[model samples]
Each structure stands twice: as structure tokens, then as C-alpha cells.
Target: MSSTLKVGILGYGYATATFHAPLINAVPGLKLVAISSSNATKVHADWPQLQVCSTPEELIARTDIDLVVIPTPNETHHALAVKALTAGKHVVVDKPFTLDTAEAHDLIAHADAAQKLLSVFHNRRWVADFLTVQKLLASGQLGRITHFESHFDRFRPEVRQRWREGAGLGSGLWYDLGPHLLDQAICLFGMPQTIYVDRVLQRDGALADDWFHAVLGYGELRMILHASMLVAHESPRFIIHGTKGSYTKEGIDPQEDALKAGVRPDAKDWGVDETMGRLDVMRGTWMQHSQVANERGDYTRYYAAIRDAILHGAPNPVPATEALQVMQLLEAGMLSAREGRLIRLHH
Candidate 1:
């Protein structure tokens, strides 16, 4: 293997163009070498030097590529990742790792058999608000958190003609944004004991579910994860209440917006979020409120860790096992919604 891991992305869609390619290129020990896209011109318009393959199979078969990043649709992740792993390349699949836990397990097994690293792009873990929440929790300022609510709501009333909003197997708000919220929650609190979900199609012409509310129970703690397409008002991105205090944050991470605006990940203020979170805690006699500065988010760290894991045997940043757990929760959430009952997790 070369000192730099050559990467080939499986698609040229929004995720591939917005997050994966730019992040891979920004990392030091990784190279965005090739991309499989039908429209080579579109890929070349941004990365003129990249090798654009006509098909994912061709890209996976390349002898020079050491890593294949699958940022394609949720349904295609399993098959493409399997092919890449079988071809002896490290694989990174965008989140909602696969449609279900079964596919996630299959991919993990394939990577193990091929002696390759497998990772999922749960990049929200590096978001500024989430990072701040981690620090605040670790500091024990919130005491023992009893209630946590996370929202990824948007105001898109009109449904678009995209695969993500289609009635396909893996198309819905739950599969689209559920992985991110679930992964972040799981990171803060381990796997929940039970999960209950309510999924709905709120948009007028929506074919897939556009809104979802999920509740994950952890003993006495109740964690709520919600996303909707019809919310116009400002909603707290994160709200946590503990025995000693409470914390509330507003606004989503800025990295995605920056990336969408063609901002390079190497910029000085790459992941700097200006929105401060309000931390209210009891200090002796009275309650005090203070603004907590956010920690800088760096999605490039994920790819960099992937580079080190492949070349230097460092731990995988977002290992297949961790993502598989997220998949389990996603599947369980669906079952809960379908059966209208709380689903219990075994492990």
C-alpha cells in the first residue's frame, strides 16, 4: 500500500460532492483519486484531475485505489461496500450504514473476511453543538441527565423528486436523518433499553415519511429524537435536563452549509459555529445561566482517522460494530412504528 490511501467514491450525488470528496481531499494522508459518475463533466467541474469511472464496479476493480467511499443512496450501500471489501479495499459507507442490521452484519463479515477496515460516516458526532454537549456532559455540569431531546426539523413543505423522498425501501425521513440523531445519542448514552417511534407523512404530496418522533428509554432517562419537514419556527437543536441543571442549544452545525457554499474544509474557521448554547445550572443558592462556547467541529478528522487506521493500524474511528448498533436501532424504530408498540433491545 502507498503512503497515501487513494480513494474512489461510488457516486457523485449531493453527499459525495458535498461531504465525502471535499473531506477526503482535505485530509492529509488521503487522496480523492477517482469517482464513479455517469456525468463525468459534473465530477470534473469541481475536481478536474480526478479519474471519473463510468460504473462503481470499474472503480472498485481499480488496482491503485486502496479505499472506496460509498456515499450513494441508502439502499445501495450494502452491495457496493461488499464489492469494495471483496476487492481488498477499505470501505466507508455513509450513514444509516445499511437499510437494516442484517445488511450491516453481512458487510461487517465481508470486511472481516477480506481483512479490510470498515467504517460509517456518522459525521454529526463532530458537529459543534454535539461536541459542546459532550464536553458539558463530561464536566458533570448537567448532573445526571434525565431527559434529552434532539430535533433535526426543517421547513421544506414541498416534497422534491429525489430518491431520498421517494417511496423506495430505504427512502424516508427516518432513514435519512435517523442515523445521525441515533448515533449521537448512542455516543452520549449507550444503547437504549427500549425504542418507540411514530412516523408520518406531513407534506401534501409526500410519498415517503417526512416526519418522525422517536423515544429511546434508558432506565429512568428518556431520550427523544425528532425530525419534521414542516417546522418553520426555530427549535432547539438539543435540550437536556439533569438533576443539577439544563442545557439548550439552537441552530444546526455550520459545516454542511459551509460545504454547500463551496467552502474548503481546510479553511481556518471550517467548523467554527457562532451560535452559543445556554447552560443553566444551580450554583449554591440560585440558578445561573451562562453561554457555553462550542468546540470546533472537524469532519476531516474522520477521514484522517480512517487513513491512520488503514496505514498504521490505529482504531477505526466509526467502526462497523458501532454503526451496526445504529442500524439495529433504526430497524427497531421502524418495527416500533409499524407495530405501534415499544421495542425492547436485547443488548
Candidate 2:
């Protein structure tokens, strides 16, 4: 248990640049010490205080680094995480934890054997809208939830020439955004009994699935997760219906754009969402509707929790076991889409 935990980030891509580095720097006990990337110009420009390692092996071998954060790509996550764990460093992997559950299991085993903390960066669990929904469900404001629909839509009409836009391992919108929705749903209502989805490559020249509409069955309750790259007009960020009434919220979380714009986690307006969700409650015969203020979101808590877990024996922020459930749902959804039928979850 170290008072100040030195951290080494394993990528310079969008995830590392936008979320991991900034959040880690903002956390009190976690220091953003080094980065592993062949292209160090961005790392130098953004965070000159850090050292740049040409290879991941070199970064992992550094004696000062206490935690290893992998934000490179979906395919490299498993290998890099395993190496770090075996090298006696705690690890954090960007979500869609690995290419498959097999890889995830092996990494978990390595972390357990090393007696180190292994966490997934499912940062969206702290999204403002999600926090609000969690509070509402817990408060019993939306009683007996029957239908839950969540959408992570975008307006990208053309595919870019990148690894994420291809049909390779861990590519496409589903593998990218699907974990967020699945993790959120599982957080709200345990695991579902069955899963169904329609995976589509909607954009022109798209090599991978750009759209997906998945339905998770929780007995009579229906939870839907949808994402598309072709949406131009606005849609509700969340549409939740229950026996009492329905709760609809428009506009996505403002944290992502803020983080990309160089806003630190401790900024004055950090985690503040200007857009609030609408809640409709039934009172006898009449329907009453009102705006529910969005809850403040804090991604720094993830890293803070990581620090505490290492220093104070607090629980892992996003434990490997919990993340494995998300991977199971992801694989089952893919199998359902491929077979054109509903796949029952045995675990």
C-alpha cells in the first residue's frame, strides 16, 4: 500500500488521450508517470511531465510504476494486461475487456495469482444520465420497470480509415459502445435470461457493424440497447417506462465532450449536465410530468477507488468478475445476431 501510486498508461489513442490520462492525473494519489507509444508527439504535447516509453515491455519493467493502464486497442488489451500482471503491476483495461471471454478469464487468473487489482474502465457507469436513472430506480420513483431502452446514437455517415472502423477483433460500434449499455443495464437489473439483437453495417463502405439493436429479457421486463452511426435527428438518451409512468431524457452526457476539450476532472463545471431528464408519474387518473435534474458524474472516482483498493484494501472499482459478466452478454448478443434467434444466458 503506497501513499502515492505511480501509473503508466499503455496507449496514446483516443481512450488514453480523452479519459484515462486526465482522470488519473486528477486523482489525488495516482500519478500519471509514463506512457507507452511509438508516437510520442501527442503525449509530449498533452502531458510533457510524463516519460515516453517506446515499447510496452519497457513501461511494464519500470520499477516506479505501481499501476498499468491499457487503452491501446481491443486486441492488445489481453496480452498487455497479462504481461503487466505477471510483472507484478496492478492493471486497468479499457472496456470490452478483451477480444473474448477466454482472454478475460486468463487475465483475471493472472491478476488473482499476482494478488493485484484488475479493473475495467467502464467509465460510463458514472455518466450523469445513468447516475440519475440509478437514483430514480432506487428511490422507487419509477415503480415496477417494465421496459428499459437506452440509445448511444451518433451521426457519423462515413466510415474512417481506422482499425476501429474495420471488421477486425474488437472493432465496430457494438463491441465499442455495446459494453457501456450492457454494463449499465446489468447494474440496474441483474443479468437477463435471454438476449436478442440485430447487428448491421449501416454506413456506406463500413467494414464492420455500425448499428445494433439488442433486447435483453428479464422475464417480463424488456431492456433494449441500441446504437447507430446514421442518426441525425435527436432521440431520447433514455426512455424508461414502468407501471407508474415513463421517464424520458434527451441529450447525452456532457462529460465526454468536456474531457476531449481538455477539461480536467476537477474543473469548476466538471460532471455538470445542463440537460435534465423528464419524468412522468401517474396520480390516480391524471398524468403528472416534471423535469428531473441530472446527477453530477465523476470519473475520477474510478481511479480514486483504484488507489484506495491498493492502499487501503477497499473494493475494486470495476472488478474483473463484474466485467466478465459484461463480456458474456456481449458474446451472447453476437451469437444471437448470427443465429437470428434469441440466445438464453446460462450463466
In terms of lDDT, which candidate is strongest? 1
- Shift in Å, residue 275, candidate 1: 0.7
Question: Mind giving the per-residue lDDT tens digits that candidate 1 earns over 79-121?
Answer: 9998899999999999989998889889989999999999999
Query: What is candidate 1's local distance difference test score?
Result: 0.93
lDDT of 2 by residue, 147-166 (tens): 99999999999799878898
- Clashing residue pairs in all predictions, respectively, total 0, 0
Task: Kindly report which residue pairs in candidate 2 clash with one another.
Answer: none
Model 2, total clashes: 0
